[model samples]
Target: MNFREFASKNVHRNIKAYFAYFFSSSISAALLFSFTMIIFHPDFVKVDLPQYLIKALNVTTIIAYLFLFFFVFYSVSVFLKSRYKEFGILYIIGASRKQIQRMISIENIIISSVSAIVGIIVGIVFSKILLAASGKLLGFNALGFYMPVKAMIITFVAFVMIGIVISIFCSFIIKEDMVLKLLKGTKKPKAEPKASSILVIICITLLTVGYYLSITSSTKTLTNRIIPVTLMVVVATYLLFSQLSVFTIKLLKKNRNLYMKKTTVLWVSNLLYKIKDNTRMFFLITITSTIALTSIGSVYAYWRDKEDQINRDFPQAFFLSDIYDNKSKVDSKAGFIEDSLINQGIEYNKINEELKFVIPDGGKDNVVIIKEDIYKKLISMLSLNANFSKEDESLISNHKVKNIVLDNVEIEVVLKSDRGLIPTFYGEVYVVKNDIYEKITGVRGYFGAFNVENYQDTLNICNDYYNNFGYEKEDKYHNNLLKSRILRSTKVAYGVILFSAIFIGLIFFVTTGSFLYNKCYMDVIEDKKKYRQLNKIGLTYKEIKRVLNIEIGVLFLLPYIIAVIHFFFAISSLRYAFKLEIKVAAFRVIVIMLIAQIIYFLIIKKRYLLEIKKSLI
Candidate 1:
């Protein structure tokens, strides 16, 4: 047969082995194309996406591209490893290394090329649905889908280049192995796997430290602690998979009854080899899954808390301020704003408070005291009930109040607002009885809040007004402007992040499942002869299935179970950092992961049993 025919036939013969890799490559390409298409879509490009968000999208796409390259390279390397005996035979039959290289290259080129085309086709077919879903996620109703030729071209070229690089790299790697080594397909024998006691202790210590730091560190310290904590957790994960798992198996083996139970001996004996060989794969899967889960979950949590965040950041629709040299000027400006809103057919609620900065009788610090009536008006507007029996006072300050002892001015704090109306002020604000408030006279100021109907629409007009006539040091807290800008930018950024995360997360999850499938198939290949002997020795098909179930179930659940643990701690750390309740998001992430795991388990179980059944026949 010609070289092309030989290569094509080989691929067709090993279609089962190649299916998962091909499927993943196709999915990777499709996801890449879908994201790139967003960048190139006519409608998307025309919209006013924030510069930061644009850069973020570009960065995310580039990262996904890099990830795909490595993913494809790794998959190809693994595929070639399984074909070592085939390569060895060709060499024995006088096929030159160069010829073998050409075959490998051709095979990869054909598979990747076909998968790439299929991926692009799939991406095109689903682009509209993806775009609409993304639109809903970002709260942008105007997003529409269109096929972008530019995106297709970019994705095609990129994957083709990746395939070529992978082929070349594989060719070099395959040429290094000797014919005998390739033919035997055997690895060097090693001492039995054992866990070190000291290493075990270290593993526990590191994991403990990582989890503690993650959970307890305040938001301010979280950034500083991330590097050290992450390093600890990574090292711990590696050690846990490598040493701790083997050690646990050894400990379990010590219990004679448990070790000798039905199929337990068979599966346990095999598990040592499985864990020893697959430690790195399990570690990789766990870490990557942890990252994906945390990224998607945390971003969703942030999006879910957007309203509270905005209200905390910008509490009022407008903060009109001026020196109280003349109440008339303040009134005139306030009136102008009111008249402007009226002329434009906008409804508004106004809160005018004349403020005086005063030094209390025994206190050295300056405090702003608002009139009782004004405070009552503000409190009523917020729909909160407060009773002031002459001496009852409320303090509005971001700082925590402990007994309110400032230079012997011992006023009990009846109520405290941690995040007060003003964003910038650090000093104390007292809403006191009119009698006490009038007792002190100092520098005075005027504060007016104009809360318009349809805050977002009025915000645009306010911005225009400010640009045309606002003054410096005169603070304007446009709630709608600040809130809308923050929400839009945040939603766009986090929405894109969450989307990419979920996409890549699924890819990683499926890749891990495929890894498990491949491992199980390889085990079946090795165990078939043993199974034939066992069949003669009275091992039934049912017994064989029971063994396979335990073996495959353990293999499948190990990485995922560990990943769920990692996700729990990671999400907990984020809760402390964001200081937002994230139970709902965390629960959703867990449910989705569980569902995905169950589906993957069913597929793997079905295929693994089929393989076992084949061995019996």
Candidate 2:
């Protein structure tokens, strides 16, 4: 009679509602918590570069919201279907429409709120996990994980708001007549005619063209990206699902053995029915699987690239450079370093560390503005452009123009040798090469590069350097952001993305795969009558399993094959999105994805077969 009693009853009635809540809240919390730790990283405070990266990472919140929103929205629909009959009951009970609406509203709001709270707690836990993971990744001591209460509030507020909004919208469904509907199941909508074969072929052709553009695109120039590929994949994915399911069913109908069998006709009919029955699920599976494969693969690729890059940054065993904030100090530091190297029993075969200035040539598309201080430091550590131009002066300015970067910048430099000097000239600066040091801008800077004899020894030297000059030891944070590309960086960037995607994809494949599994198992469950009738005539369990296996294989493998092919071309279409130069990257990406795909298929297939065996038993 009262609100509390009504609420308790509603809660008891809807278990799926709770699951929806749990999934939504948990996913949201995880992303928010992880992001919070990433944004104001304690480790990054000392490392100036990470601080900037942290800032950029925060901007990706929109992406998280989009994902969570889809998850929660779709879950509500699924939950509703399970409880639709209950609404019919309420309608039959002679409850006033207003009363029914009130009850449903209370139920939805309560479920959403409870779910959001649980999600935040789970998120808090996941935050700790992510922080710990990041610590290992950066090779830093792990801090005791703690939630940013403020972040908790923000996540809590946002998801709660989303829940309330979704619930309020859901409440309106109560207005539908519920009583008479209780006796009859919801009416099935009439199916549309099958897509025209010619139209389907035309679409396939167009999708092929889209894919061709992606694979052929030069990735080096940022001319390509994920957008086109993603779109192409989506369109192709849906079309393939529609076309393949229909065409295959029609093909099987033509086979005498397949069509003439008693229940085989029914099974075939069911397959055609499901092609219509599972349209929404098909769309979801297609997209989710594609994203998953790409995401998991991308993360590993990105990480590997970073590792390769760090290794390539220094190839020798041991090397050191001077520490200074200006040209004069830099020259003196070079002397200090040279003396230290000699005193330390180190031999240098060639000039290991060279200095140059990276000046920004501003442009619209550039996301990373490689500033003077950062570039100077990078160039000093490795051999860079010797030419300087008036553009190089922009490095001294607070806002450097990135468009001009790698453009018309003049450089001047001199090469020092025991017997002679070689001078090089560029736009503005004159070369004073052939000395103990190379000067860039004659300004105070802490940027330099090095190559060493051995990696481990160099690591130790770096440790010592960090002990002296690392984040905590440094008095202030420098805002120099320099970006570099590793040959494998693209793969790595996509690897982590691929990992999350695959994690979700695997979940989706398995979950939806269940429906297919169930269709096979349903025969076993309902076989008593059908078998009794058949036995009166003639049949065996072995024959039954054989027939069932064929049916299940067609059902399971058909969409999967279509999805796999769609994903391949879809991935190819991504060429323009990533601006990937070196088409070889796509090949490498493909190989990695294939290896992972095999691994994933093996796992899911094992689960599917287990279900089949369980059903047969």
Worst 10 residues of 1 by lDDT: 474-483
Candidate 2 local lDDT, 350-391, one digit each (tens): 332333333434533311122333344344444444232343
Model 2 ranges off by over 4 Å: 1-4, 16-52, 113-131, 147-159, 177-184, 189-193, 210-217, 261-263, 310-333, 336-450, 455-617
Listed in order, each prediction's TM-score against the native is 0.86, 0.61
Q: How many residue pairs clash (N, CA or C atoms closer than 3 angstroms) in each of the candidate models, in the order given?
A: 0, 68
lDDT of 1 by residue, 6-88 (tens): 98999999998888788877877787788778767776677677787777777777777777777777777877877778888
The whole-model lDDT of each prediction reads 0.74, 0.48
The superposed Cα distance between candidate 2 and the true structure at residue 361, in angstroms, equals 20
Q: How many steric overlaps does candidate 1 have?
A: 0
Off by more than 4 A, model 1: 187-190, 320-346, 352-377, 387-394, 402-415, 423-448, 452-485
